[model samples]
Target: MSLLDRFEQAFMPNYGVPPVALARGEGTRVWDVDGKEYLDFIAGIAVSSLGHAHPALVEAVSRQVATLAHTSNLFVHEPEVLLAEKLLGLLGAPARVFLANSGTEANEAAYKLALTYGRREGRSYFVAAENGFHGRTIGALSLTGKKSIRDQFGPFPVDVRFVPYGDAEALRRAVTGDCIAVFLEPTQGEAGVVPPPEGYLRAAREICDATGALLVADEIQSAIGRTGHWFAHQADGFVPDLLTLAKGLGGGLPIGACVGFGAAGTLFGKGDHGSTFGGNPVSCAAALAVLDNLDLDHVNAVAPRLRSGLESAAHPLLKGVRGRGLWLAAVLTEPRAAEVQRAAAGAGFLVNAVQPDAVRIAPPLVVTADEIDALVTAFPKILEEAAQ
Candidate 1:
């Protein structure tokens, strides 16, 4: 039997059988076992901020594994401390960090902190926006407003109130003195890269402050230069009380962090919450390498060029483009996004059907202009096929 066949036979059905087994990657490109190259715009669902096999990530992972890999939560390691420091520095406020393994885990940690903080302080309910996706876990999912990802996983941990996103009036009306936190993604990634109206984040922050509730920002998909800003909320000049980060935090390695600022920072005390592999040295070191290799240059110069290249490509099926920096969504007239996604893959440019009529294009920060141009050149053909 073939390797894929053997794997399919052994494993339970979950993600379904993938079409191709990717062998390895370099920069913004990956190859199947058969050595067919694909331009990777998906970037592992926005986790590969610096692209695959980046020298910085490679070196850091190697050095850390060669030295020290894992230690107990009772102990502190340099890489973990450094990674925490780096995250805090990017944050405008002095913050405390709790690390986890994925975006959902990070949001779970945040929810726990918020609930604990609110319960101790006499608040009970949490307010989240419609179509807001925090994660899959019960606590996080409870806060998630999208029914499709939640209805099956019923009886969640906490009671949550949902409001329409990007509407200040909805937020103001929903949030009351009994609310614990108002949670939202600055730019809703799973909602077809929907960016909230300007000043909405600040409005939410204000409402949270007035109601004595924490404002939680889920920057997991948009942070670390995904949306042309370190934290997507930063672009709006709103500071959140609790921030959940993952996806691109470790630059492809699994790592997540919940950063609580000001008084919210100390919500989780000793013995409150912990993780075994939360601050694993290798992952933290890899994250640091990713950070070192990406910064302002990625935001100002490279992202715009890539955006232009993508925007430069036009087709009858494509209606418009939206998003900031490298995080972009190509709006199409038809809802056959999955078909276009297959077409993009067939054309050697990997894209995501993030919504019914939208394809998300979030390439690595290291994606060159020429490579982007190549993808653009191939995209029209896919769009044409999508038209069919």
Candidate 2:
């Protein structure tokens, strides 16, 4: 039997089957089991910021696993403390950290932080951006504003108010004293790399402060140099009381973190929140390696180059390109974003259909100018064929 056939009978059909079975990867490229090479622009849904098999990440994980892999939460590991210090330094905030295993777990950590923050006074409500994607878990899903995903999930945990994204006024009014916090993505990745208007974040910060609500920035897709910023909330100078991170933090391995600043940092006392596998030495080591390689100067320098390459495009299929740094979207004229993604793959590129009419690009910061040129060169033809 074929590998796919054998797998179907053996494993649960959770993710069904991936279209391609990857055997190996290096830098910005991956090869399927059949040995067909493809430029990996998806970056594992924005998870592989440094690309597959980056030396730093591999070495870090290997070293940690070889030395001390799993130590229970009962013992404090040096890697965890070091990672916390690194993250706090990066954010330039006095904060406390809770490590987790995925984006959902990171948001779950944030949820607990919100609950703790809300327990004070009388606030127990949460406000989320409409069409937002938080996580699949119950608590995070409760705050996720996507109706299609939530409707099937049934009545969510508690009070969740969904408001139009990017509308500061709408968000301001929605988050009152009864609200614990507002969850927002700097650039809505799944919703198509949509960046809020300038001053919007600052305005939201003001409202949250006035109402005694915490501002939570979900940087799962936008952080870790994807947008040439350490944290997306820093773009507008908004220091969120709570911050959630995952995706690129581990370079490729799974890792997540919920960061609480100032008073929010002390919201949860001992025994309030805990995770068994979070802050595992291996994951922390991998994340530290990612940080070591992804220095601010280097990642920041790549942003303008990526923006310039996409912004100059004048094609029939493309409306415009939007986003920051290496994270961007090629807004399409048609809702056939999936077709364009497939065609790009056939043309030796790998992009994503983030929305029906937007193709998102969250390639590794290490992507070369010539590779981008290759993308730009093939882009017009890729769209033309997709048009067929």
Candidate 3:
């Protein structure tokens, strides 16, 4: 049977059975089962930081899996310890790390940490932005701003208040004394790579301070060198009390982390929480290689070229481009992003129509100038075809 055929029979229908079945990948490219190659702009939705089949990641994961694959939370392991230390070093902050298996799990742990911190102080309300996408778990979903996804899963256990993203006044009004924490994304990713106004995070910090609420920054899609910084919040020169991370941290392996700073670091008690396969040693090894190969200098150097190339394409269908570093969105003049995506795929490139009018481009950090130029060259034609 064909791969998609097997997938439909075995797996849940949540993903709707994509058309192509990828057989192999190398660098910033992939080939479907029939051996048609395409440039990968989605990069596993920003999870493949070092690209597919990276030697470093392969070797590290191989060596670690041969040595030690997993040790539950009941025991300690070096890869986990080393990875935790490495993450803290990258953050350049004194914090404690809790490992999980994916972005949702990371946000779930962070939510619990916030709840634990809040319950101690008798605060019960949680605040988040209107368009922010956190995760799929119930509590995290409650904090998520999109009504279409969240409203269906009614009667979430927490009292969550929603405010307009990038509006400091709206956030300030919502974070009253009853509020426990304010969950936010430094840049809203799934909402078509939307970045807030300058100094917005600093404003959040100030507001959190005034209300004695924790500032929890969801860095799941923007951190780990995706945005020319180890963490996106670092570039803005302020620190969130709690940070949730996943995607790209483990290269392609599944891993996540909930990092807590200052008093928040010690908020979880003995019986507070735990994960069974959260700190799998193989995943940590993969993360180490990913971190080593990231090379911020190269990313910073290449990013502007990519951005300017897309902006200078000068197609009538192009509205504009926005985002920081390698994470970018090409805004279309019309609401035909899905058509543009299909056109790009037909032309041997892959991109994401994250919204009706936005195509999100996030290739691996190892993506070269030539690969970006290929996308830029093909994009105008792709847009033209989509317009038809």
Q: Global lDDT for candidate 2?
A: 0.86
What is the C-alpha lDDT profile of model 2 across 285-349, one tens digit per residue? 99998888886676677667767767676678888899888888999889989899889888888
Q: Which digits, one per residue and each the tens of the lDDT, describe model 3 over residues 126-180? A: 9999979999999899899999889999899999999999998888888887899
lDDT of 1 by residue, 1-388 (tens): 7668877998998767766678899999999878899999989989898899988889899999999999969799999999899888878578889989999999999998898888898998999989989998888899898898888989877789898889999899989999998889998889888898988888898898899988999999988878777888888998888899998889999999999988888887789899999999999998899888887565567777766766777777888888887888998888988888989888898899999999999888788878877887887788888788
lDDT rank, highest first?
3, 1, 2
What overall lDDT goes with each candidate model?
0.87, 0.86, 0.93
Highest TM-score, which number? 3
Shift in Å, residue 164, candidate 1: 1.4
Task: Find the number of clashing residue pairs for candidate 1.
Answer: 0
Local error of candidate 1 at residue 328 (angstroms): 0.9
Q: Cα deviation in Å at residue 181, candidate 1?
A: 0.5
Which runs in model 1 stand beyond 4 Å of their true positions?
none
Worst 10 residues of 3 by lDDT: 169-178
The TM-score between candidate 3 and the true structure equals 0.99
